[model samples]
Target: MTISERPVQSRQDYDGRSPFPGAHEHPAASRTQVGLTGAIVVLPFIALVIAILLAWGRGIAIADLLLAAALYVVTGFGVTVGFHRLLTHGSFTTRPWLRVVLGVAGSMTFQGNVIDWVATHRRHHAFTDRPGDPHSPYRYGTSLRGQLRGLAHAHLGWMFADEPTSTPRYAPDLLADPAMVRLARAFPALCAASLALPFLTGWAISGTLYGGLTGLLWAGLVRVALLQHVTWSVNSLCHVIGSRPYRTRRHDRSTNLWPLALLSFGESWHNGHHSDPTCARHGMGRGQIDPSAGLIRLFERLCWATDVRWPDPERLERRRVDVARKARAPAGD
Candidate 1:
């Protein structure tokens, strides 16, 4: 069925509110809470600075660079493929063990617990650039000054906001699962392990305290900070810049920024995703490199993932704004 022809559900359904539930209120963050949130965002940059200083004296080793790249890929995919496509959107189905592994790896990124991450993301989709969206560059007015403020807000300032998205209101499915609940509770431990493991690996490989520190700097802090900015760019620049080739729901102005495609693992195909959120493949067009989609395809081939929601060309054609405009135009014109 066409999008317009599909049965419309209530706002509650679209928001993923639980039918069976108590109040899922997210209270305003206190002064102390906001301070802590700011610290979390800032500490990584501090680490990056320290890493650079250390590199200035010792020089960056191949092992350090390799470790950082490897960990970045793992934790990055943990967010893109794991927290996003698999948990938030259900673009594909995987084995139970694989789900746990993905969830743990994602938690290691320190983005948030799985449940909270999914809840915030689902809420973002439900509201998009509209009033209830947790993060949107259009939240403020559209004036030049307002746009600049909103860009910063959407990019990283939103995380320091007093209020947060309620899990019960937006991720009841994840809350209902015992395994997910367990994983969410383990977020703290996973974060500690994420940093510690790299340190230990460096120490073991080089048998020196400096090696361990370098590993912690590169794989732990620098990697996390890099991923964090790349992800935030999607929220800010993806809406403000790039090409919008597909027709999305009203008020949704997601765009595809090719420069971020590789770093974000295809998530920069924001227009394609907002147009068809559940499609496993975001880079539908040619020459669009989507490593995440390629990884999903590999899993499918290996029988590790099933019922993958690969993009449909017919649906894409139907959603193309140019095509829709042509179809609606007078034949003589």
Candidate 2:
């Protein structure tokens, strides 16, 4: 049965409203929250160290490699295609069962509740790399030290802050959905599933408890750690290292880092995405290999997704021209 059907009881927990005049937050950061973020941030680094040690000593089995790859693909797409595209952007649609499954899988990514995910992501797009951008890789200005600090900030440090983005403005649609709301509330369980399922699969396949432990360590914890970095790289590395193929209103430097394309699904095509936010496919160009788009197309063939906003040649050409004009125009025209 679909899980998003539970009715919302009250608006007390809702934080979707734009605060009124004179209700400004005295800007602050919570040290406790920062410490928690530090823990989360450091935990992954330690996991990386452990993984490297394991690999160096050859503790990881072939089965663990296969299991890790399999889990990464699932959770990666859960965030890329399912969480970012389907739920956050509404670029296309999905069947009820698949939708619920995707939502649950994405929750296990340990990002946040689905509504919060969608809301924060939408706000990021709304003000990418700009002042209101919650996690811009260039927040601290254009000095080398600043860029380093900003990249660190953008990658995951911003999560240390306590000021939550009011979800009502960014994700009213998701908030209104009965099933999505319920699925969002199931985030804690989904996170546990993310970790436990890998161990269960490993034990069942290898018929050993040691296999299960490695699976949980590699596929469950370590995999989440790696994918989390890759996902955040769209915000940090993509901004700092890649090429900007398209234009955007936001002053943010979003690049299409080719190295990350396969790993991040089509999301490495960040410039195109920022330019055409509602388009179903981020890698709209011919050479771009977007597995997420392919999956969506598969769904379309099966009569699941509809109203896909595929790129149009005319519109793309115009967008390019507009970008050139903005770049080359006289300073005071």
Candidate 3:
């Protein structure tokens, strides 16, 4: 269905004109609550810097760096390929076992359980930059001070809010799936394992408590903080900055932020994604590096993924704003 024709809850239901029908009402966060939430978001990056300073003379171990890089890849792809592509958008299909594995890996990223994450993302897509969007940089207003507040809200402040997206409305498929339910329940344990695994790996490689601590510091806290910001950037900056190379449904301001391309594992190709939400490849044009797409291709080769939704040139051309503009121009020109 066209975007305009898609079903939407009444504006009053979503725009806070009325309380969400059956949803819990959360008061605005108090100063203490806001402070705590900000600390939770910021302290890790501070600790990471301190850890780097402490390791200055000794230098970070090659093993720790490698462990962090490896874990980053596994967990990052778990979000990009698994939580995002496979489950949320159905960009491709895979074996049930692989699906569970991907869910587990994504859960280890500590980005909430798959169901909640998917539900939140689906809601974001549903409203986009409109009044109901969960995290739009334009939420506050167009004034400078308002934009700054909106940026903060979009980047992280919204997480502290008591508002919750309805799982049944956004992710009923996952809610109905036994495997996904079990995986969601296992999220806490997976989070602990995500940290502990790096520590154990560091200890195993260097056989020292110091090595283990450093591993926990770098691979655990720092890695999580970095990935968290990269993901949040897509919600905040991708909507406010960067190039909107493709057309999307009205009010979707998603843009392609090339700087975040590698870090976000192709998710930074926001325009392409909003243009074709289910397409497996976001970086459809030349020199658009998309490691997530590469991983998906590898899975396809290994017979682990099937029916991949690689981009179609004709569809892409149809979606291009330039093409639409040319089509609208006078026939003589």
Q: Quick one: best TM-score, which candidate?
A: 1
Model 1 C-alpha RMSD vs. true structure (Å) is: 7.5
Q: Best candidate per lDDT, number?
A: 3
Off by over 4 Å in 2: 1-36, 51-59, 321-333
What's the lDDT for residue 286 in model 2? 76
Lowest-scoring 10 consecutive residues by lDDT in candidate 2? 1-10
What would the TM-scores of all predictions be? 0.88, 0.85, 0.87
Which regions of candidate 1 are displaced past 4 Å? Answer: 1-28, 323-333
lDDT of each: 0.82, 0.75, 0.82
Pairs that collide, model 1? none
Q: In candidate 2, what are the lDDT values of residues 1-333, reduced to their tens digit?
A: 122211212222222222211212324466876775576557767766776676785666888889889888887888887888898888887788888778877888877788888888988887666556677766665568767777887897678755467777778888888888998888878888887898998898889996787788788888888888888999898877977667666355677788888988888988778778888888867798787888888888988878777887787766553556657854311
Which residue segments of model 3 deviate by more than 4 Å?
1-26, 29-40, 323-333
> What's model 1's lDDT at 190?
92
Error of 2 at 299 (Å): 1.0
